[model samples]
Target: MSKRNFNKMDDDQIRGSSRVLRSSLAKKGGHLDEKFKKRKMTDLDPRSSQVRNQRGRLNQTKVKGTKSLAEKHVSTDAKKGKQGTKTTVWSIKDKHEYKIQLPLSVDTSISWITGCHLMDSGEIIMTDFYNKSLKKLDRTSATVTVCDLPSIPFGMCYIGNNTVAVSLGQKLQFANISGDMNLMQSVDTDHYCKGLTYHDSKILTVNDNSVFIHNYNGKQERCLFTYDSNAYFQGIAVSDDGQRIYIASWNIGLVTIDNKGNHLFTLSDPELNDPFRLSLDNHGNVLICYPHSNIVMQVSPDGKNEMGRIIKATDSIEWPNSLYFDRNTSSIIVGCGGSAYLYVFDLK
Candidate 1:
């Protein structure tokens, strides 16, 4: 046999061969929809989630699948009490229970949004990760102003009465999130800090594959746990008592974690092709936007009460990147990175 030189092939050939290997490994018995039927040995089926292919056509059937999961998991707290009292928790088994739409004017490629928190004056504070800016929108005045930060802001959590904790690219910083976007203190880290949530006097942040928990005063306490490193992670939202954390992993499932970042539960819906951002309403319902299908899914924390499939969530929502819920008003806001729009869905 002659001596072989492996460097002779071009980049495409090498990549093509690697893709073939990955495809083979990915085919471990999960039956995808007809849309993902195999095409070639070297090419990942267009319907497969390779993330390298273009956005394919939305599948209404798949969207419905995700909706059913949400309906099945819808919170039942409301059923245990009075009915129709604005104070009563609404258990939605379908999207028809609430209104979904793209909000007017406010648009941008928002990597994330601070959950709608009313300031001391009743204004909503929102920060955009990709836009690298923060804004306080006056609910009564309808005026908006920007908040400046030391670095690119990724996440924000409204700390009780006045202040908000903001997560910087490499550290955790305190901002006058309730008033004037003031940088108070910061926690240094070695990983790329992406999301933050506050609970029970503790602040949690997601760093790459690991989750870091710190004291509210910006001091490193310890790492809660590390997850599968391959999961592409993003923003986070926490429940009221601070026991549950809702994690949004791009193209992955919606994961639940403890205050210390310990993985508690995961709702990996095969029909949920991608979940870019995540948020939980006061009713404990999860509102997610699936761009590929142009549908906004309102699911129960347990993945119940799914609405029929809709492609509208992907229509004008180019690159739906971030999602947040205004617990005060029960509204859902979605951040579209490409179209530069923040679509707000009123759930009153």
Candidate 2:
């Protein structure tokens, strides 16, 4: 053999030699790359790109399957009254037994009872929109005008133990209702105020198509969100956690949004023909009153399902406008637009 000339070896020759050495070691079940030296070399090697792709697909399928199972669990648990599921507390089967008639006098001149709230003491407060008056009915059914508003009083909600905030056109009046209704202060808004609710120490008001959020002192913090003008926004309610807001419209059903003013979804069920006012039970179930349909429906928080009609038209519910769920009594107080009677239903 001639004198070895290692220095004369070209790049291709060196590479070829290394490949041969690696091939020999590989045949002996040895790995050449330090990164994968100790790894297994099965047909389904974890380090292989094909295996990784397969794993990714499997993980995706597993995630989807888990979500589907969770959804099914919610549906099944609703009927079973289990946690993580909507309990069917309100139902039509118990409708007739729970109906309590309001004690309004037959001679009362109240035109349209638009908004209402229930106090812990079992008192029902309401706004006579057409009469431009705030009225209260004690637990004994004795009704009286609490105070007269300058503009039409559309919506009202309790802001304090003995105080309430009433929406009157473009102004929100803070009224004290301890002994008698007295205007404490007022807050002005850019748009008209139709419905009002308090959440996270803030006042949420709605008008034609816009929702406005304001501080307790009447300062407009922001316009929460606006809906299409074709649909008239009527009733408003805020979730207990202040994370979600539910709005009722005339033509459209209900619109739900996050606290950050993001539109989450719309609930326009055929059963929710004319959603007027909305309320939330302790469990965050949506209680909606439909005037045209003369019915009150309980819906899931996600707006994907309607629990059922809590009070149906056949139950003698007519022109249901304002709705409130009383935690103390576990009852729903419904005020009508034209009728002098307020219907109370105790959930079983």
Candidate 3:
């Protein structure tokens, strides 16, 4: 073998010379040297090594399949180069310009507003866990006591035009409302019911850490799934298509489950402390109430990202525990757990 001097050649020139030599040998039908063939091949160009490393990183990110929790909460419109300074897309103002406060009945002092649902007739139905009663408030700010429950009510959701399902203790009660509330039937469960929602003609109830499904006629269906033992499940909501179910846990944050009881994902944030209740917007986004944080947040349907803060704590929203998106008026009805007033925000 003849030794070639390469000290004077540039990087690209050396690479080109090597390629030319290899091609010339191939044209002559010459075989590679045994030593050269036995040597481990390595990329000679730094750029080629860099490109290969970058591609490997991209493949790893694709395998992960989801953004990190910190990245998901960041605003998409934030400044690209700013490190530590993140500007939120949504802002909360103190003045109730787009908000309306409707007070409940003067005779009834609500201690904890746990559940709320918007009716087709523009009336709002709420459950008072401390008072052990369900109340209805009309559009005109007129309030009426619907009915009293045997135990503390935790969550509620609308089943039909005039039908509602409420979770009270270990029993799930389905009631019909006209001028007054009447209990149609009740289904008994093994655990105490804490949150309830209707989806795909089935009743989804959260009893302790487990979730149960039932029919409307007081028949026990299937115990769908359960969560972590340490997690205290508070609120539950189902998608309109009945393909997904969202649950709010005090310990582990918001969890998403499929219709067949498969765990999909969990969304937890340092800002989203104690997610208590859940509701779905018209666009199929998840709206969660953080009572301890005194804020209401809107998250994406996949539970991978937070859309924005719908209600901020500085906006005079005190301990909001329940959320109801009223499609008729395009508003959000916020029920406070520590306050007596209910706030309504005009959805923009």
**lDDT per prediction?**
0.49, 0.61, 0.61
lDDT of 2 at 175: 67
Ranking by TM-score: 2, 3, 1
The lDDT, on a scale of 0 to 1, for candidate 3 is: 0.61
Residues 236-341 of candidate 1 have per-residue lDDT tens digits of 6665545667776644566777765667777666765555456666655556655434456665554434433322533444444455655555555555432322
Mind giving the per-residue lDDT tens digits that candidate 3 earns over 1-348?
A: 011121222445434433453443232223334443322112112133211122111011011122111111111111111222122423333222111112222112224578887666776788866445566766454444446555567778776647677887677776665565655556677777777776655667876577888765535688898875867788898776677889998778899999899999999897556688998765667789887667888888787788788777667666687988765455788887534456788765
User: How many clashes does the backbone of model 3 have?
Assistant: 0
Q: For residues 83-166, could you state the per-residue lDDT of candidate 2 as single tens digits?
A: 344577475333321112221221123235778776656666777654455666664534343455655677887765566778
- Which candidate do you rate higher for lDDT, 1 or 2? 2
Q: Give the Å error, residue 190, model 3.
A: 1.2
Alpha-carbon RMSD, each predicted model: 16.3, 32.2, 28.2
**Which ranking of candidates, highest lDDT first?**
2, 3, 1
Clash totals for all models, in order?
26, 0, 0
Clashing residue pairs for model 2: none
Q: Name the runs in model 1 displaced over 4 angstroms.
A: 1-120, 178-180, 258-264, 291-294, 303-316, 339-341
User: Per-prediction TM-score, please?
Assistant: 0.60, 0.69, 0.68
Q: Candidate 1 has what TM-score?
A: 0.60
